[model samples]
Target chain A: MEHLPSEQSAAVRRIVAQHKERPGPLVEVLHAIQASFGYVPEGAVPVVAEELNLSRAEVHGVVTFYHYFRHTRPGAHTVSLCQAESCQSMGAEKLAEHARRRLGIDFHQTTADGRFSLEPIYCLGNCACSPAALIDGELHGRLTPEGFDELVAAKAKPAT
Target chain B: MTTTVYVPGDAGALSVGAGEVAAAISAEAKRRGVALDLVRNGSRGAYWLEPFVEVQTARERVAYGPVRAKDVPSLFAADFLKGGTHPLSLGLTDSIPWLRSQQRLTFERVGVIDPRSVADYVKHGGYRGLERALQLSGADIVQAVTASGLRGRGGAAFPTGIKWKTVLDQSAPQKYVTCNADEGDSGTFADRMLMEGDPLSLIEGMTIAGIAVGATQGYIYLRAEYPHAHAALKAAIAAAYQARYLGADVAGSGRRFDLEVRLGAGAYICGEETSMLESLEGKRGEVRVRPPLPAIKGLFGRPTIVNNVVTLTSVPWILAHGAEAYANYGMGKSRGTLPIQLAGNIRRGGLVERAFGLTLRELLYDIGGGTATGRPIRAVQIGGPLGAYVPPAHFDTALDYEALAAVGAMLGHGGLVVFDDTVDMARMARYAMEFCAIESCGKCTPCRIGSTRGVEVIDRILAGVDGERNVQLLEELCETMVQGSLCGLGGMAPFPVQSALKHFREDFRARV
Candidate 1:
């Protein structure tokens, strides 16, 4: 296993310690680690397993089973487009195609510029205004190709 | 005096730019020197009319809708604060036909009050059920729920009282009350709405359960998709703690009930009760075999009462109003009201909470205003991803659990995702299989393997490669999954495909 950076290892230890006392704290601990760092670093798995008194395979199995946890670092912004039945009825598939072409990335892939990572979310519970997308955790609905472009452009703008 | 304006902070409202509209209103208010008390409340579930702005006047709350940031200046110019007229104005908020027609027992305070304020919650009849529950014995509370005929609103339709009673009967000292807030269904948003709008009700409901079942701990297993709801629930739980509604001594009754919100990773199977329990235990969200129900032994090997967000949220209403009052509203078994979510390709998609007797036609056309695309209505997918699709012929079927079951459909989560005439049934059937393949927990072979086979068979049929044989194979595979699967994810995943084959078989025919 690759050696984790000193600070990243310390951060992982801190997150695990914060939630290790709860009834079932593995998922919560992982969430905190992901929240602190963009994704769960590969090196932190053994550390979490050792701290929680579980096998390294148990922690790794959990990380792979749930779709929410990420083993890799994502782009600067994450764009999750709804691909479920509700959004499908409102042209989500077409919108998804447009998103891919515009972003130059497919689902689960980061853009070449590392500005955006695209993901397919089943539902965001924003079905009322369908063809929804969550860009960097902010929900946007009634998204046309044009609307999606505008949102991407706005997010891509550099801070002054 | 400061004029009060209400804008929804609901995810649905925010998705359509309610946040921008709120900012614009505040900026405009500052510029005009108007004394404004702008409040970000929850959505009314009339999502078509969101950023559904309401202003509190002396008489009533005036309504204006679908407001954009650009419309703010014009709304101010029209003196909307004093019930002024504008093109977007829809008169009094309460008097709006769409909202006024339905019975909003569970959602009464959702769009009306500030979500985070416990004092505001108390003022609006929020804790009345908990207060009433505090006065009664656990058995009496359970009996009231049983008498109310309340069933699980999370697609299973299990009796809420029986689940509680089992936990109440358990001899275990460390029992739990887990609210399944993992609302992963495609068209469902009622759980999300209530949590965001009136989270105190859910907190109150869970507290009542904890007090009744002799459980001291509660956890809300929320989905990770709803960050807004997470924030709302966290804030509400804090306020409830600070206000003494949730702590070592809940509401000063000297009974202990501690509550916390635990987030679920993006696993659709976690919506299932057993899978949810496993997920809560910080493991893989695989479905557990029944006979050892969550009520008897669940959540770290203790008696646990697992109820949906809507089911738990509805408890407060049943306790506040008498059991008969709730039982009086619905048809036969499905008592009380259901917060029916109208979504997808519909003109007026939103949450419509009503008694259980209304026909799907009334909901789809009268309430939903038909398809948003102005095309003829084709099909409606009732329930979630695992639910069956109903054709236009069955649209008149009443929205009851048994009525829907009679028509080969289930009222799973009371979500109606409408589709227009342009929809291709064959493609939808394929998507169903695909979704199952993606979300199946791999606990059961029939679900894990059969779903993938189902998908491939559909693809072969669609490609015109011996269509008849492949279609037959697909049917056989579905049957295997239905009969052999351990949980609903595999069992009911075939419902949509089977329904499409039964109702719209021509969609499967290969075009030469």
Candidate 2:
């Protein structure tokens, strides 16, 4: 009875069509939807379910299960801090606290200015250089509180 | 001759300013009018020396590292292009003691070759295994793997050959070979390194598995946390398809095998094989019961061969070389080499691929160069978040599966995370439960509910509110999770907590 924005609906249909022939293609479809929109909009779920011949609950269950899927619109830049044991061994907890205070937002929260969003990642597979973080998909290792501030500040400045 | 330079595009290297170093070298070399060819290679598994740049000389590759962007001009002035001496130069990279002593079998071409080049991978003995497999029957291939004694490198230590044999024996219309590239374990990067370094080997390995198990379609369940690995795998897979190494008629064998890489969002439990298969099916990452194991009924109700990236990658070597060649290395039943990832608070943290007989002390001190802080080595959490906290007393124990298991520790994926004297045992113990609680897949009662209670018990013990009793309760809860949980996630999550209680009882007492 309801519909998404025409453009988003078309994109979702295109993604589902590409993967519909493959066995168990719903996850791949969801991944494509998220990649296009940065987050799976609430409007995209029902469209995906209908196109993929799955229930709405089935679609929503998967979206909520994994921590990586974003439900809300992210800020200009997304920052993910590794909160696993390896990072914790090298003071990742303190680093996380520092980032929270610096960004003025806790994990899973966006800044008021919409410049940054923070999330806690399990691992980035760069444990050799512990206390790692990903700012807009670029990983930074051996992250200290000071280095993190410098990185955030550097990114905040407007490009020439 | 154009001077060839290598700056690792390995994510670990890129993370610590290697990208900036590469840019500086490019700009500086252009200004100096030096003709240079820059090849973005993978890390040599030496974290301490990264942005470890190498220059090709007639003798060997000359290494200079921990190189910063500012150091690029000085490196150029010092005639590093000609392998001239510099303060940072380690001269003849292979001669470095850290990398020289280890046996790098699975990681043979990791830092040496261009990851996306099929020709480079082939020149370095890449598809020889698939070549050998095409000439043999599926039964014979399974027999060879079984004879090699190759076990699962995904922490389960299940016999890989037996898993393949099950899939081979099963009568299915559509069997599949699924590589568990979901390397979500903390303090482990061997899978990432291999994927980013020599992805062709993994592709070859999967092809061989498909040939053995009669599987035409394969899927690589890669974790999304490693966007760098994802990019490398995607590019390499395209190259493999172009070269006729992946799609139908692989290597002109007429036996079809198509491989695809599916990304897992951010679930840690999906590292488990059944959970991985469940996630692959577009479901919540809930663990399936194992009456009809994944070997029999997996991946869309067909027989499946689910293996770790290392295990499948190890297959090419086992097939290329004789089973005896692989079986000859290591101690006892744990045959072949393991890519041991030394991480966390270690001075020379990197990957050390060696036979399984090396002791924890040798790894921590000799290879790892002890704690990065130069303080006393207090504890080392072997495996990952699900592994045990090995004390200094057990440092003499061998790293083989049986040997480590004897000491109540499992060599789960060969990730050893070191800790210095400043570590808080109680807090570390609390974190183990907290991590379990956070990541538990909520299918069974013991795992989903027990983890939450275990955290509360640890908090109560730490608060000294009837500390001894709460500690006992924590132990009881750990036992329940171990015996009652459906999968290894809950079953082994209490290992660190139990080990902490067993060895660092004094720390808990002090906290109380």
On residues B305-331, what C-alpha lDDT tens digit does candidate 2 reach at each position? 999999999999999998999999988
Candidate 2: lDDT over CA atoms? 0.92
lDDT of 1 by residue, A1-160 (tens): 8668988898889889999998889999999999988898889999999999999999998998899998888999999999999999999999999999999889999988889999999999998999899999999989899999999899899967
Instruction: Evaluate every candidate with DockQ and list the scores.
Output: 0.91, 0.84
Colliding residue pairs in candidate 1: none
- DockQ result, candidate 2: 0.84
lDDT of each: 0.94, 0.92
CA error at residue B428 for candidate 2, angstroms: 1.3
True contacts kept of 1: 0.87
Where does model 2 exceed 4 Å of error?
A: A1-3, B509-512
